[model samples]
Target: MRDTLRTRVRLVGATMAVSIALLVAVESALAHEEYVVDGERDVAVGEFLAESLTDPFVVGPLLAGAVLVLVGIAGYLVVPPVERDVGAFRAAMGEYRSYVPWLLRISFGIPLIGAGFGGYFISPAVHVQARLLQVALGFLLLFGFATRVVALLTLGCYLIGVVVRPILLLQLEFVGGMLAIALIGSGRPSADHVLQRVAGTPGTLYGRLDIVHDRARVFQERIREYRTLVPTIVRLGLGSTFVSLGLGQKILRPGIGLAVVDKYELTTVVPASPELWVLGAGLAEIGLGLALVGGFFTRASAASAIGVFSLTLFALPDDPVLAHVGLFGLASVLLITGSGPYAIDRRLEPVETEEPADAVPEAA
Candidate 1:
């Protein structure tokens, strides 16, 4: 019994070490190609596809690695972690439910503000700027003043930008983050909460003059029932964004992706051909996106998304950090919330009698 336990511990440690090494190896190739590539393809389309898709060196390892990962995941599902420990973790994460609004605000606000000052749209690749509009919206969100309204306003602006410049679609996670804030409303440590408290007090000066307080409260109450959809909305938004980037930018536009790989000399970093780098990155992103979209192993997928974002930042310093901020925040939200309703994970795992402790509860 003792030797079996020791062997299991060693196996777990070795698995972790190998996983980390692989993650680091692919970090550079996994970065968003548009951030660095000038989009002029030096390689021909036919050659790039043939080399990337047909090369045995790349194809064999990718297939083998995927099989190993899937088998490991299956084993994990068959024998999940200790139930008591999982429960404790869930309870610990649950305590932070009230802070979701604040997290969303900061995640998006800083980036918007930076974008305004940096003279770019939501993405660094898009150079057009609306400093005043973005700054105002960002500030209001950060202050948590009229949060839901501000979030809606931000969404409107993003949609407008998308209409004008389709490239803004790359930052689609903003829609999810904004919609989440709109649904959840501002929690504590916000101007909304402070004013609400003041308006409720009998003798407060501001309370006497607060004309819209009661209406706003009523509206929030009315929408509270649908707030449970926050995670689902977020998953769709982020997942769609990922699929777009992977399929539209990388897979369909392999020339541009290959250009990025060559320009950065990324092949040297991972010792893979430029074709393999581009293809692998695109496929990895698509896989992650599909996982989120299906809500299969939702929490793990969210965590992987966050890790990918972090790796992208490190591998390509020129990649606009601001553009990824909303995505990072949304993934963080998922990490805390887990799979909400309509998740495959629910069907696979025993459906808890109650929601997971991490489910985003109604905001205070």
Candidate 2:
């Protein structure tokens, strides 16, 4: 029964993860459609350089540095083994656990609540019903209250919202985040943890918030177990984003790609014609994107993506540069870790199967 429940939980998680990847793809296409400028156009090189500097020149390395600093502090200062880590130390505690499953929930949950309240108080003409509910979701996530329920419902809310902004259906990474929440539940240290302690039994409580998994245990062990999830999400996000952009903007609409490329004024810097460069980049993206999706040569593709996206960052204007920054981060992860457990790279690896029970065991 425990195994069955675990399997179900994993299934839910997988579904959510895939959904998020798709969502990013869809939303990105729509977002791309809205793009109107080639960042390095008629504007002076000085102007471009000035603007680029303002937008974090190296998004991944910098954000990564911050995370590492926080982790260092977490390992040194918060160093777990206690409970006062809550109230005054909550923010610090969060940074300590920022890379864990619970981090995704809190990170996303805060925004949901903000949007909910913002809609309720500010947007006089938006999805009133959804906005009101998101406020509650924010609180639930913050407290880790009925987490699985909140996760499922949040996925539903995303689906409903997608009907309006069907483009969100493309945002697969967010879906992956939700899936992680549903599968992993809110680590330890929440109302769910407290209630589970009160129950003192290993079983489901309040539908699927998971009270049995030691809700009383303030901090989670086996942090290493969830390590693969980060890469999986990264693969999906980077793969899907490239596939959509390459197939949609470059390959299929080369004319449109040409139009965008024509705006680039980097001829003095780059010897190749802008239009030819765009076409060549499109083909390169498609090839690399396919490799990422297939999980073949995952590291190579991801590394290429880092370079490709970095250059694209320079070519595009403000909004796209911001979006590409996030892409570079995703690519950087796959570059470091490869495709992860779920990829074809792993699947194709040779594994020794156990000898059949009825057959004589083979001599080593």
Candidate 3:
């Protein structure tokens, strides 16, 4: 039962995913903490705010924490044995010249750290338990200690935040990045790397863990190859969403599209009837969507998406505008990392049959 680096990473990833899923379930269960202020009384909000003190809400964090600990142990034990070299993938990643994944993590994590600290310090004046929770989890992430556990908690906290101020829901974009870090480790310049080194990674613990490092290395490499498809999946998702919305304009929500033209009174400004304007806009949306899903002209399409979403934001009222800011972030990211490895762009490159030893799996 010796665990290779590949096994360790996979186990950690699965554990984190399951833990987050459990946390989401728990969060939903306690989404609205009502209380029996008087015997058999139900009040959504009260003068005393007693709901937070009730048994179910009180135990939510404890329940989530317990579940993660169990998941961590179970994940450590059941990571499927694989044949692969973790270093080989690392080397391949470096050789293939794909540092966008790492860059994404670093960029996302750094700002989040600043925001977390900001929230932590500002929270005490209010004497709210939520801010204290934010502070504790913030420190955990800042140092990368039990990274996934802290990330899941942070996500749970944000979920609660979204409940309190529904406007905060857009901030879940930040949470998605945290969850990614949780599943993938802190991605260099973090405590996880230092700890791995101290443990004599790929060596001292090998005999104790009963892992087949050689086979695991091979398995890890296979995962690395397939991993390139991940970004493509996201790209296609962005495209498909636009495509669906555009189609919906024609069939389901034609009036909404027409309203955009009429509400703005673009008939004289743009020299087009509302019907014609809506039709053209829908076509543009569909074109952009096709380009994105196909992974063709990635940068242009992503940039266009950024423009479209941004302009759309201006026309939207406050609530919808808040929700859309996340979409803008997603498009911004796509603009930075176009098409990625598994894309139509790849087919245009010279045939590459030789798999390099330095290939690294994309961060989960």
By TM-score, the best candidate is 1
Ranking according to TM-score, highest score first: 1, 2, 3
**lDDT, candidate 1, 261-329, per-residue tens:** 777788888998766787788888888888887778887899899899998888786777777888988
Candidate 1 achieves a global lDDT of 0.74
Tell me, by lDDT, which candidate is best.
1
The better-scoring model by TM-score among 2 and 3 is: 2
Ranking by lDDT: 1, 2, 3
**Local lDDT at 266 for model 1:** 85
Candidate 1 lands at a TM-score of 0.85
* lDDT, residue 145, model 2: 81
For model 1, give the 10-residue run with minimal summed lDDT: 18-27
Which stretches in model 2 have alpha-carbon errors above 4 Å? Answer: 1-33, 36-151, 188-234, 264-269, 306-310, 320-338, 347-364
Per-residue accuracy of model 3 over 1-364 as CA lDDT, tens digit each: 3455566446435533533343333223222211101121222323212423254543454456458756854564367232145234333544533443344344444444444454421111111334445555556555655555566666666656555543242233444444444434443445544554444455566434634434434544454443434345446546655665565433233455544555556677656455555555665677777777677756557788988877765644332343344345455546554565446645643342323313333221
lDDT of 2 by residue, 251-298 (tens): 544545555656655554666554445445565666677677667757
**What are the runs in model 1 whose C-alpha is more than 4 Å off?**
1-33, 42-47, 81-85, 353-364
Off by over 4 Å in 3: 1-99, 102-222, 249-251, 262-269, 314-322, 349-364
Q: How big is the RMSD of model 1?
A: 11.1
